[model samples]
Target: MMMQISIDPASNKHSLLNVMHRFIAAANNMDETIMVPSLLRDVPLEEQANNNNNNDDDDDVAETQVASNKQRDMYEHYLLLKSIKNDMEWGLLKREMSSGASFLEIAVKQEEEEQQQPSVKRDLAVEDNADLEHQFHYHLRGLFGVLSKLTLQADHLTNRYKREIGGGNFMR
Candidate 1:
């Protein structure tokens, strides 16, 4: 004998919480699948190269070099995904700011930029509570899309890792 659990599809299907849980599960699966993180160290990400190639704004040699150096290997991506999952579960903690700029300075610069913008644009920023709810939903939908992509990426990485170790038959 077996017991079955019922769930309401309408309530859970497109919910932000559900999307987050999916990402967390994928991240956990990735963490378990990759036993040796160092194996991924020098492996270049295809998506990163594609993204860099798509951007046409890299006109300067220094900027191009910087962008190339900014590219992370699979190991870094694994750590990043795990870190993001941890942050999503436990909430983000503030870290020490870099020496480049202080928070107050950044805030002042933003205020100046906002002031320089047109009055009409600033007026449009003001909204009622209903608009706030709409904005929240809109951002939530975008977040869901991003998280879903990340979940798929995690699964892809796991499969890639397994293949790298000559266990190509194993996949999730």
Candidate 2:
């Protein structure tokens, strides 16, 4: 006897959401070595410094900064997709499918900039640590870009949802 397991192409939203939840859960359980570097993209020193300027302890700030890189790069891509899906699910960005357009253009520009990073005088002076820092910076930028977009999308969807479903009587 033979058995087959097939995923329906037209599954319902609830199942789709369940799959997303599972993905997030799996990401949460991944080891730090695998996860940390995944979340980084090159962010400017000024921005990074601003992000960490609060009174939080250095370790706390470092953990948050590093956490973004923990997921795999492919996961980062899907996470972007999921974020847009979430925006729609909750009713944020306009329901049209222009989701990846503007963002893709921006990402392409950033990738180009990443490719153009110069190896100069500092490159000669810096050691392996510099290489590591550069890697972390690139990942950090990618992470920040993804997060900022997701947040905006989520907020937009929430406002739309609230407007469409107007506030009602309490049922508690």
Candidate 3:
């Protein structure tokens, strides 16, 4: 069976939205550059500090800090994309899409950054042991979540999109 749809080629709003979706797609896939970095951009250091700072035990605090820091970075990109609206949003989006990284490289970078902290090194050693399983589950959950959201959006579009007669145009 043949299925057809129409889109107005000159809609700037749609173009802008497409750009937004591109970044979102990258983030949804957990790409380190456009997605992960943006995820980290807005996490106030104060909150990060406080999350682990509450622990009285220094070792516990160190472990908590390392764990939470990694968590914060994981979805940093999506959070960033969610924060973007009008105004300078395009600039941010442009920069992110132009430069992003894979999960492996991001991990390497994080390792390099934490190399100086011996306590974090211990924590990282612990983390590395289960890295594959953690990544697998995280990506699995992310996959479902992104698909659910995208499916909902597609459903909404299907509901709104009306077919036009005698032409390849669709009315929304």
Candidate 4:
């Protein structure tokens, strides 16, 4: 797989892998909860909290994040396996939505729950087990759109070449 090529020790993934050392070694300390793709895009719940915390009603966003037990991973993307398998973090978020919890609300509640405790360890290691923020997923959605557009462009180029240059008459 492309991931293996990029993650190989001889490969550039250690430099390129950013999130995990055995993966991307970005700055020697990438957040473990964040997906590599999400980090590459610089979208995370912590960052998003700052943007959405302008109103007094949303003030809990930042305080909650800051107050939460740091023992837990701030983001949930890297903890996901299917995302790595499919290489689609956005899909992981969508799938999380199916669990009946809105992404934003989960992000908010998680802080409230963690802050109320001192030793807040979790067991999100199960497949698709944790409730993660939506922003990470949305970032991946944007990535998916870009990838789709690129694929479309590649198809267009192939069709144009066959019809215009090769005159293959393969039109349907």
The number of the candidate with the highest lDDT is 1
Model 3: ten consecutive residues of lowest lDDT: 157-166
Clashes of each: 0, 21, 6, 4
Order the candidate numbers by TM-score, best to worst: 1, 3, 2, 4
Tens-place lDDT per residue, model 1, 1-172, is 8999887654596877778888999899999988878778777644344334533342222233323434777788788888888878866432213546677877788788887886856577774443998888888878987787778667766765765577432222
Model 2, range 75-146, lDDT digits (tens) per residue?
A: 343345455545645654333335655756767876787668756434655765658888877876675555
- Kindly list the per-residue Cα lDDT of model 3 for residues 8-54, writing each as its tens digit: 54444335445445445433343332322432343332223443444
CA RMSD of each candidate after superposition: 11.4, 17.3, 19.8, 22.4
- Model 4: ten consecutive residues of lowest lDDT: 19-28
- Flag regions of model 4 displaced more than 4 Å: 1-132, 168-172
Q: Identify the superior model by lDDT, candidate 1 or candidate 4.
A: 1
**Candidate 3 — number of clashing residue pairs?**
6
Q: Deviation in angstroms for 99 in model 4?
A: 46
Q: Please give each candidate's TM-score.
A: 0.58, 0.25, 0.28, 0.22
Candidate 1 has what TM-score? Answer: 0.58
Worst 10 residues of 1 by lDDT: 58-67
